[model samples]
Target chain A: MKKVALLTAAIIICAVPFYGQHFITKNGHISFYSDGPLEKIEAHNKQVNSALNIETGDMVFKVLMKSFVFEKALMQEHFNENYVESDKFPNATFKGKVVNMSDITLTKDGTYEADVEGELTIHGISNKIEDKGTFIVSKEGIHGNSKFNILLADYDISIPGAVTGKIAEEIEITVDVKLKKFSK
Target chain B: MKNWIKVFVLAAVVGIGVLIYVWFFIYNKPHMNIEKATPDYIISASECYDHYANGNNNETLNYTGKVLQIYGSPSSIEKTDSLTVVVFTFSTGMFGDEGIRCTMLPSYSNEVSNSILSKEISIKGYCSGYNETDVILEQCSIIKN
Candidate 1:
C-alpha cells in the first residue's frame, strides 16, 4: 500500500508542470513593411492573440486586419478598402507548429533557434510556410521573435496600376510576442 | 494671340491649385477622429463578449470596423512597452483568460491610469473583431460621464 501511495505522489508531482505547459498572450505585436520605388509603407498591429503549447509544439496566431495602424490615414484607408479588403476578410491567422521543439528547453534560461512550419492565411488565402525564429526562455516568460518576407501576389493582394510603384510586391513581416504561462 | 496666352496661363494656374487640393485633402486625408465620432453600438463588455464567445461569427462580424462603447469593470490595466492596455476578462478558458482587450489611445494614457478596478466605467473604441479567444479593440478612449 505504501508503494502505491509513493507512486501516486510521484505522478502528481510530474503532472504539475504539464498543466502549465500552455502559454498565451493577447497583446502580441505584429508589423509589416513594404518598400517600393515611390514610397515605403509600414503598419503595426499590437492587439495580436497567440497561443503556444510547449509540450505539444503547437502554436497559433490571429490578428484583425483592421487593427493594423499606418502612419498615414489615406494609406490605411486604401489598404482596407482596396487592397486586403478587410471588410470581406477581417482576420488573418497562422496555425503552425514548432518543428524543432525538442531542441529547446523551457525550464532553462537560454535563447534557442526554432523552425516553425505551418499554414498562414491572409486575405482569405492559405499558404504553407517554413520559417526560422528564436525563443528566449526566461523566468518571466518566453519571448518569441521572427522576421519573414512574403509576396503580396501569393496572398492575392493586388496593387492598382496608378500606385504600382508606390507599394512593393513583397512585404516583410515581424512577429514579437511574450507568452506567459497560462493559469486558471 | 494674346488671348490664347492668357487662357493658357489661367488654365495652368487652376490646374496647379486643383493638384494641391487633391494632394493635401483627398490623397492625404486625416485619420478617423475616434474622440469626436459616436459609438455605433453601446453595450456592456460582458454582453459584447457573449456575442463572440457563443460562436456567432456572423453576429460578431457586424461589429467589426465599428466603434463601440463598452461599459464594465476592467480586469486589469497593463502598460506595455508601446501603449497601455485595458482588459475586461470574461473567463479563463482552455486558451487563456479570454475577454475584451482594448489598446488605449496614447492620448488617453493618463485617463486609463486613473481607472478604478471593479468600478463601472465606459470605454469607446473601434472593434477589431474576435481573435477566437478575445475581442480586440483599438484606439480606445475612456468615455466621460
Candidate 2:
C-alpha cells in the first residue's frame, strides 16, 4: 500500500514537467474501411487520446474499441458484441517512436514526413506496424495523418465461413489527429 | 383437416419471419438515445474519477458500462473543431492532466458557446472504461431544468 502511494505521488510530481514536450489531443480520429464483393463497410471513432513528444519523437495513441461508431446501428452492435468483444478488451492502442526524429523541427511551422514504427494492439492482439504519415505544424497546432492496411486473420479475428464473403480479408485504417501543446 | 394444417403452418412461418426481422432490425439497435435512458448511478465527478483511480475491485466494476450522472466543477473547457469537451481532471498524466473527458451531445452546443471553466454542472453519459490517464464518457447531455 505504501509503495503504491509513493508511485502515485511520483507520477503526479513528474507529470507536469513533461508537459512542455508533450503535444496532445483527446479527439483524434480513426476510421477503418473494408470493401468486399458483397458490401463496403466502414466505422469511425472520433474520441482518441494521443500524445507525441517533440523532444524525443515518441508517440502513443489510445482509443476505446466501443467508441467506434458505425453509420448502421446493426453493424455497430455486431462489431462490439460479436467481433471485438469490447467488454473483454475495451481499448486499442499504439506505442512507438518516429524513425527520423532529428530531421524535423516540430516547433517551427512546416509540413514534414513522419516515419513511425510501432506495435499496434487491437482486439487483444499486437502486431508490429510501420507507416509513413504527413504532418503539418503551424500556429493553429499540429495535424498528422496516416493510412495503412491490415489482414483480419493476422489479428486472430475469426470470420465464420458463412459470412466470409460479406467481409474483406484486409481492412484499411486511417488515422488523423490534431495535437496542441499540453498546458495546465 | 388438411386446410387447418396449412393455415397453422403458414402462421408459424410468418411468425418466424417476423421474429428474424425484429431481431436483425430492432432488437440489435445501438443504445443511441442516451438522454431518455435512465442512469444507473448518480455520482459526483470526483467520486467517479476516484472509483476509476483508486476504488476497490468491485467498486470499479460497479461503475463501468453503466449510465452515470456526474456533477462536478469543470477544471478545463476545450472546444475543438469536431468536439466540445469539458474535463474534470484530478490526476496529472504523463502530459500534465487527466480526469473525466466528457464529449457533449450536439443539442447543448448553443448553451455552452464558450468555456464554462469553473461552474458546477451535472452531465449524464454512458460510462466507458478508464485508461490509466482518464475516465471517458460519451454521448453526454447537460442536466438542466
Candidate 3:
C-alpha cells in the first residue's frame, strides 16, 4: 500500500507539466465500392479515426469495423460476421509521417500536395503504403483528401467464387480527413 | 509425495482461474461518478440548443437520455495522470458544418449513472453551452435513450 501510494504521488508530480494533444475533430470518411456485372453498389462510413502531430510528422488513422453501417441492414451484418468480423478484429490503423513536415506551416491557410508513407495495419495485416494527398491547412484547422487502391488478395482476404465477380478484386478507397489544432 | 504434488497443482489452477475471473469481470466494471446524488436541473439537446440561442450564460446544464447514437470517430483514448481520467475527440462534423465538435471525456462511471456508449445511453451532465466552435458535454447520465 505504501509503495502504491508513492508511485501514485510520483505519477502526479511527473504529469503536472505534461498535457494532452487534443484533436478538435479527429475523424475522417472512407468508402467501399463493389462493382458487379449487373450492379454497382457504393457505401461509405464518414466516422473515421485520424490524428496528426503539428510538432512531428507523426499521424495515425483508425476505424471500427462494426461502425461501418450500410444502407441495407443485412449487408452491414454480413460485413461484420462474414467479411470484417469486427468483434475479432476491432480496428484498422495506419501510422506514418508526412514527408515534408518541416516546410508545412499548419497555422496558416494553404494547399499542399505531399506524400504520406506509413505502415497500414488492416485485418491484422500490416503493409507499407506510400500514398499522396492534397492537404489544406489554415488557422482554422486541417483537411486532407486522397484516394488509393487496395487488393483484396494482398490482405489475404478471399473472395469466394459465389461472390467473386460481385466484389471487385481491386477496391478504390477515398480518404477525407478533417482535424483541429490541439490547444496547448 | 505424489498426493501432495497433486494438491499443489490443483491449488495453483484454482488460483489462476480466480485471477482471470477477477480481471475480466469484477475489476473491469465501470464506476466513475462526477457529481453526488442531488436533484439537479436536467436538460435535453434541443433544450440546450435553445438556451444557447437565447444567449444564456449558464455554463452548466444536465442532460439525461439514452445515447440514441454516437456520431464521431476517435483519434486516441488515453488515461491522464488524474484518477480515472480520459480525453479524446471525434472527427469534426462532416459535409460542410465542422469544428471542435462534442467528445466524451474521462468520466467516472458513477457520475455517468448507467449510460453506455454502445447501449442505451442517457447522460445527465453539464454543457458549456453550445458555441459555433464546440459543444461540451459534462457529468452526464444514460437515462434510457
Residue A1 C-alpha lDDT in model 2: 100
Q: Measure candidate 2: CA RMSD.
A: 4.8
Output the worst ten-in-a-row residue range by lDDT, candidate 3 chain B: B64-73
Best by the TM-score measure = 1
Q: A1-184 in candidate 1: lDDT tens per residue?
A: 9999999988986765334378888779999998898899999998888888898788989888988999889899989999999878888999999989989999899999999999999999999999999999999899999999999999999999898867789999999999989876
Q: How would you encode candidate 2's per-residue C-alpha lDDT over A71-126 as one tens digit per residue? A: 77777777888887877778888999888878777769999999999999988999
CAPRI-style docking class of model 1 based on DockQ: medium
How does model 2 do on interface RMSD, in angstroms? Answer: 2.8
* TM accuracy, model 2: 0.85
Q: Please report how far candidate 1 places residue B110 from its true position, in Å.
A: 2.7
RMSD of each: 4.5, 4.8, 19.4
User: Model 1, residue B68: what's the lDDT?
Assistant: 96
In Å, residue A128's CA in model 1 sits off its true spot by: 0.8
What ranking of all candidate models by lDDT puts the best one first?
1, 2, 3
Give one digit per residue, the lDDT tens place, for model 3 in A8-70.
988975563222343434346778776767445566754566767655566777665544546
Give per-model TM-scores.
0.88, 0.85, 0.52
| Whole-model lDDT, model 3 | 0.54
As a whole number from 0 to 100, the lDDT of residue A70 in candidate 1 is: 94
DockQ top scorer: 1
